[model samples]
Target chain A: MSVLYSCSHLDSPHSPLPPTYPSSSSSYHQLDKLYFCEECDAVRCDQCVAVEIASYFCPNCLFDVPSANVRADKNRCARSCFSCPTCESSLSIQASDVPTESGQPGPPYSLICSGCRWSSKEVGWSFEKPTGIALQLQKMNHQTEIVQSEFDSLKEHLESYISLSTPAPSAPSSIRSTRDPSRQISHLTQMAQKALHRDVGGMVAYSARSKGRSTGKEGEKEKYGWDELGVYEAKGSWRAGGESVLDGVDILRDLEDSGAGGMAEVGKRWGKSWDNSKMTKDVLPQRIPLQTKLTKRCPHPNCRHLLIQPDTKSIRMKIKMVAANYLPLVEIGRRRRRIPSNDMNEASEQPTTEELERRRRERRRTRGGIPIKEEDESMGLPLKRGETYLFQLALTNPLYDPIQIRLTQPHAAKDVNTWCNVSIPTQHFTINALKDAWAYDEEEEEGNDDFLIGGSEAGFSEEGTTTTGGGSGMGTLGKKSRLSILGGQGTKKGRDRETGVEKRSNTSKVILLVEVLPDNNTGDRVRFDLEVRYTYKSDEMATPTEPGEGSGNGEKRGKKEEYKNFTFWIRIDLGVVE
Target chain B: MGAFDPIATYEKGTYIETDTGNKVSRKATITGATNIILGGKSIIQTGSILRGDLRRSTAGQHVVITMGRYCLIGEGAIVRPPGKMYKGSFTFYPLRISDFVQIGPNSIIEAASIGSGVEIGKNCIIGKFVIIKDLAVILPDTVLPEGTVVPSMSVWSGNPGKLVDTLPETYQEAMEAKCKSYYQRFRAT
Candidate 1:
């Protein structure tokens, strides 16, 4: 079972969020990817955290580009690292095969894509030296110079009205750049302004008169006429080479002549060189776009603690407040489907795969968004309706000291139409403390293997094997198996080990029996939430003063020890009934 | 289906377990054992090839393949030192593979250095001098070009392998867990 923990941001920690809201799945994430804020005592996901770039580096060259140079280089590599325009793979520099008169080897070098064997010679770009190709391209590329000047002129033209005008009310709308990217050199200032979330100096500005915009008559213009600020007269050079329409016609004709093979994909047209490279031949090798290491902070305005601060030189994180260290790693696996008995429900008959598919299609028509894992049995097969299946809900305690876990099913949302019968047989269990890797190996030799493979027969504390009932008596009761510090090794294996429970190292695997109820409709969703509150001794807390807030079934601890209670919710989607 | 269901099982004499916990399959093609260094708990699976004979030309007993702990060379994978022409002579470079590196089945790796937690998926052709940094994933059937530099956290895929995505920050922990579990599961039964 693929599990996702709920990050109930709005809900109070005391109140468990009822799994009713549509798109609640969006708030769920894998425990490992989630962050923990110590102050808030809540889980923080990627969506909730604030992100800032830690460092910029070239993916191709692996060069750590300084932040200053990132802006100057337009967030792309300034070095000789370029990706092939055709295949989008990094290019390698190759020297000219034909030697000069002196036969002194390399002088004229060209970038070539080893994947596609596409050479820079296609674009007639041959550099004298191989080292600094981007620098050389800056001097040689006259087209970009013209484009940059044009962008500057357009920005300068718009800056006039913006300087003289009042503040605009509707400022959140993206400021559209003047250039279409059909030409070279996209306006970097607009991009930079957008990145910084700064208000762009623009033409449309609200005045005192426009503040009372409701007073204006329908289909009538304002007296100031801010809409028609100025006419952009085309520059002389642009007007002189105003053959763009004819050029488009020529490109269309070329497309007709060469077919679809001549065209470039939309993804290839953007990135380093944001150009109208419709044709494969028009695409030029661009400097590889830079990648950034992000520094994430807790999004809470008050508690802006560093969640992740990646080091510039190393892959290590300077400050990582990951939830994995603080919370129990919950994994639902070991799915065992019960064999359908003849006397029970065989007379009622089961729905075939085709019937289920058709009903699923009908359900899809009504609700098109909720994604269900269909047909891919790599992770798990679909849970069949009217059949009882056994699952192991394994909780791995990350703490050095052993943890007591209490599992309870949260009351389902109002809709009982699409629900299942979930029976968590063993409500409470204790996982052994996480020790060094070698400690487990030594412990195994000492014969602590009975707990690793649980016994399904009867409860035996001395054997370290508790809980007897399996799927036969799924929801027998809320049985609390108090497994005290498992002392000196018990050598014997579980006499008759079954599928109900298993434990290894710091992980405790308990049986979770789920009976998929038909509830009239088969294709609708049947998911349930499990409330897991783990109590672990807090090493840093002052013990004598703090009362370990008596949660239900509180086990008395040593006077010097303090217990910390943490509660989290997990939603398990028992796949559609077959 | 489950951890209880062993990920892999073999005959009693299928693998020869080294003192450092390195398990080398008897069927694996290993050359010049003296030049090869397998860090503790590594597994060289059946039919996999490790070329330790292809050491540096100027060396006297040079270590060729220096693999770190919990490394898995999958079935049919070939790992050899990267070779280059230097000063009118062809010489080999030592292949350094760090901890928790899982080279999947049928992958041919001629990379110079593979950092810790790097996983190369099945049928990948990792070309010569490819410097894969920590926590990078080379997806299955990927063909990385020669001298390609794969930085940390990036996932490379497709024929001409490009940075398709990135790994989560907790990938190192996950990789370590996976490697350890796989090592535990792989045993002589």
Candidate 2:
């Protein structure tokens, strides 16, 4: 029911095209999600884009947290923003209900959750002031202080051991050369005259350095890549397996009464991995995490150009090279299935199907005659086997100048689930250039409106049901004027009744016939990929090529308009067949 | 797609139409008429309640409920301002709902500010002082807690209202078009 373009992840411009297997969900993306790298001339998806944080800000307070304090603040709001421990929503500081001697609200302020009606009073956390609550909480123990002090003591204990283990920079190199005989101390040899340590090298120097350096503690440092630390003096406070298990008996008793409803969910304990509480009541409110705006670049190391650069101060992007600007918008609409006709016009919606059947009959009359199905017009009906369905694929030109589009099935799609032959009646077509509403004359509007009212099947269908992103804010009047131009004279493709393809304004609609084949997997939606190659004016002037290929009219010899071709693959999904 | 949908014709005298094209249903209950301001082209459906009476205790004139253009308050929805005790006294804060915001049926919104192009689905309980930024979507049956800040271009869902996904860049224009089309489709039979 939707169309998604595939990104190959890497682009090698001159190499032969690789067969695209777009069945993988990760490889396909909507046009808006894709970026076009001009240097490489290829589409890039999020998977192939390099992202770097530009700025960090708190979602709740909207404060731009400075980079220096980001680590110290632990990527949370520095001021007074905190979520509720119970519901995880942001908490509000409320004054206590008790009245003062002056008949004003009391000084005791507490955090409250309006959602679950949770209060800090239950946890014995009452602040003298409503503001700067985080600073006030820091003064209290909260178990964090205990953990911090123990970690500090451990670091101090290891300080002396690390310093003694480190070899001094001024130490005699003769001892180091003695430890490793293979290493030549070239610099030490230059300073050898000042201190004649050459005899100090080799066997005797080895014995001097090996006395204390042979300990594996030095090797353990290199093996595990741990930082050098000092002395280890075990304290009475630090005892292994010393905590009592009987203290948790109350928690078990509470669990028996309240069941698992008293327990905290896994998501609530995400950032509190160091000391997470199993009981919901024991969990305390934490600061909300900060969000970041990221700058995106092409993943290619050689071609690391900025694809998206967001402004640090605002939501606006300084530079964006989205693929929507470069590619033609393709949309499939006006779906109709072919039904058995008793009596219909000889010049039907499809002339090619009748011609092909006639040719097949002439070649082999012994075979059963092929039945010509009529256009049913009613859409959303389950497709029948051996029936033909016609679809209108509208390609809106993105460029200001006219472009020629050639849509072809590169090869038979290898999808095993769906069985349907999708064919394009008109392989090649030229779409008009996109223009502003004011640029289009009013006469054209009236002319196209007539087509809409007169065209039998076009008064009110899902004309704007675009498979991709909808049309850019073109006024309703302009869009209606150019939606249908049926029975108009001197059109480029004059045979509208035969090919069933029409053109109005910048959009060109083509007839796509899908013939359903009987299969066991008829429940699956019919899907296929199309390779669209568009030839557009490149606008190169430095070294212009021959001017004959500019606009197909072989005109404008003086003007330098080089044409370039770009090809991209798109996968379309049709609803399930009956 | 909304442009192709059938016109939603309401019976005559059901909705009172203003010169600014705002449609206020006759059956809807609107309190504190002097404190509420409905922007041009907005619609208040039947059974909806706008509590503009929850104004500040101060004597001077103050707009309590200020809704913006093209906003839609669905049936049975409650729009009330958030109030709290500040400086030894209780005072109500003004609720500002901006342009193109659609609050679905039976939802209760006591938020301080609901920004432009926000779509709050049916049966949602938007808590007090919840500031939902532009182009955000709160899914149906969501229970957003008090002071929850829903950022721009994000989708919020679930009881506690955690961000689930983000909207595309084109969502702003798409939402504007949808709101405009829906307003145009709504008419008198």
Candidate 3:
């Protein structure tokens, strides 16, 4: 697993065919890429978000393109910003030092790629000014004019044939007289039938189709003889000295002479210079394409709330609804293998034998007290089946107010091969509210006396965790009551043997016992899902509108308390079984 | 997937505090220590290499590496001044690192100047003459090109680093707290 943790999208959470279930591919996105929709209370991924282009700017020059000019410019930079045809890097304008008739160095410039040292002079291109190279190339290039005239002539030749096939409003009377008698009678009957029943839509289409056909029997006016139809040649109308069938042969010879490095890649030739047939030398530089800032909205029909609103001037998103901000950050790190209780008893019975010597070596092997392992290495080791390992599960609250979290394993995981049991040592615990980092230093120095007083003033001391859950209520009595509830409950302080790691702060850590049971059909890996439900107090206060107060009693304001709960699931993959 | 990391337990005195209030680890290799000037409360973690011997060719007592206050060079990180050919001979340029600059573990920084409040993530390669402006974050594994100009408040990531995102308005305060907390957490057994 990667450092990034994400929620798996259970597409068919209630599918009956668990054995043949198709897992969703969206289970592996980084937290930064996932968006959260508050309205739908569901995570919206990139696959589901409706992306709309907010602004388009050239990646090289960073100039915003006008919407009207986007189509004309073919969604590329119009301000003479061309990338290298070979390296695809932005090309810079370099001026040449050729002397002019005025006895001064000329102001002639050429497009040059600094990365590959490719210059426009190689292709015999030079310009008086640095700007508008594309416009100048189109004006002076003779090959482009020939291709343009050829396309125009083809369109002109096909104009009459296209118009002739179209349905005509008026048919010539001389051509109608020379038409086939049998076919003319059938056409007349259909037209007469349509006239008799004008409301019939089916007969209208039949008459329209018949009118589109040109009658071959109509040769009365001799507009074109049957022999003349075969002599129509579109290529004969080409501009003088433009139609050269030897152009392909000449290009092939040039390609055979040039080096392989001179030819552009298929990707580079496909963009902008699409009609450039000379593969080796004719590939021209293209304008840098524009990049867009996207505005993503929820795809849900009922709730189309904005998910991502990117700022145009800066890289910051104006409205970034990432799921990481909403969900509690969970990190699992410390790993330690547990030695069986029976093994210790067996070692004690051996006294000075080889078994006792082996125990001494084992203690030396684990001499680091708590073996420090890398996150990747710790997960790499296989866990023995039918063994129980103690771990610490910590939850950090993202809100300003203290939150109560309830974590549980579901009865069944959809299509997993194996499942493990997770036992929480402490069922209910309150996590401290997030505060400014410097404030923590001050709170630590004042000791627990001031802390207890502050907790009571918040009126949240009853079921509170000492650092966070205190508010105005029973004052000092509230702190005493909470102490009594936790007293003798073995809320284990400091370190414990067999427990991997322990530390206390705004992040609440609790001991968890994960037991992998021995199975007849054993699998290499064991995976399970955890359901996390958290209840947090809403910041928005509601006031009761009762009329029991005295007149002008706005000074004695009362606040209503509101709380909300959210549930999400996380899958944990315990790699390999010994 | 859920395993508690044992090494994170705080153990005091991992860093040796000098008379100047700079917390420098004894394990850190500091060559030409006389040429390095570290401002107060700066940290040089274990296995870090600080090369202060590379000086200008024509210089008379040039300070090769100068780090300002609250700077942290993480474990296994390397800080070396950029050098280039000058007047037909090679010369090393001075690396000036401003206050509140935290270079993450295993990062190799040869930049000319690193501005204040710039936090470079782990395994980043800051190329020669790279000018990083204040309040910038170079994400993990970013390999910036030579002469890259990193603008203020921008977040750069990936190889041949591109501007990926911008820092929030409260980034300065957040970064200061994070650096302070990391320094506080480093301790010896």
The candidate maximizing DockQ is: 1
lDDT of each: 0.72, 0.70, 0.62
Name the better of 2 and 3 by TM-score: 2
Top-down TM-score ranking: 1, 2, 3
lDDT of 3 by residue, A289-360 (tens): 776768889877777889888777774679878766666666554444555545454544324425434644
TM-score of 3: 0.61
Q: What are the models' TM-scores?
A: 0.79, 0.74, 0.61
Better structure of 1 and 2 per TM-score: 1
Q: What is the C-alpha RMSD of each candidate to the true structure, in Å?
A: 10.2, 9.1, 12.4
lDDT of 1 by residue, A1-578 (tens): 46778776633453344555666777788888899877666788888899999999999888999999899898899999999888888899988877777664476899998788999999999999989999999999987787787778888988886653433553553233222341112223333333565534422322222443556644223433443347776454544654589878988899999899888877777642435447888888888889999999888787798999999999999988898888888877666665543433443456554554454344335333543222212234656665556676778888888788899876554233335556675787777678776776654444333533342224344454433433222123332211212222121213321323345556767777666665436565557788888887765543332222235333335565757777888887756555
Clashing pairs in 2: A157-A231, A158-A229, A158-A230, A159-A230, A160-A230, A161-A230, A161-A231, A162-A229, A162-A230
Candidate 2's TM-score? 0.74
The best candidate by lDDT is: 1
**Model 1: runs farther than 4 Å from truth?**
A14-21, A100-104, A160-230, A236-253, A271-277, A340-379, A413-415, A444-501, A519-526, A542-560, B1-7
**Worst window of 10 by summed lDDT in candidate 3 chain B:** B1-10
Residue A61 displacement (Å), model 1:
1.9
lDDT of 1 by residue, B1-189 (tens): 123333476889989998999999999999989999888999999999999999887846799999999999999999999998765589999999999999999999999999999999999999998899989999999999888999999999998898999888888888988898788667775
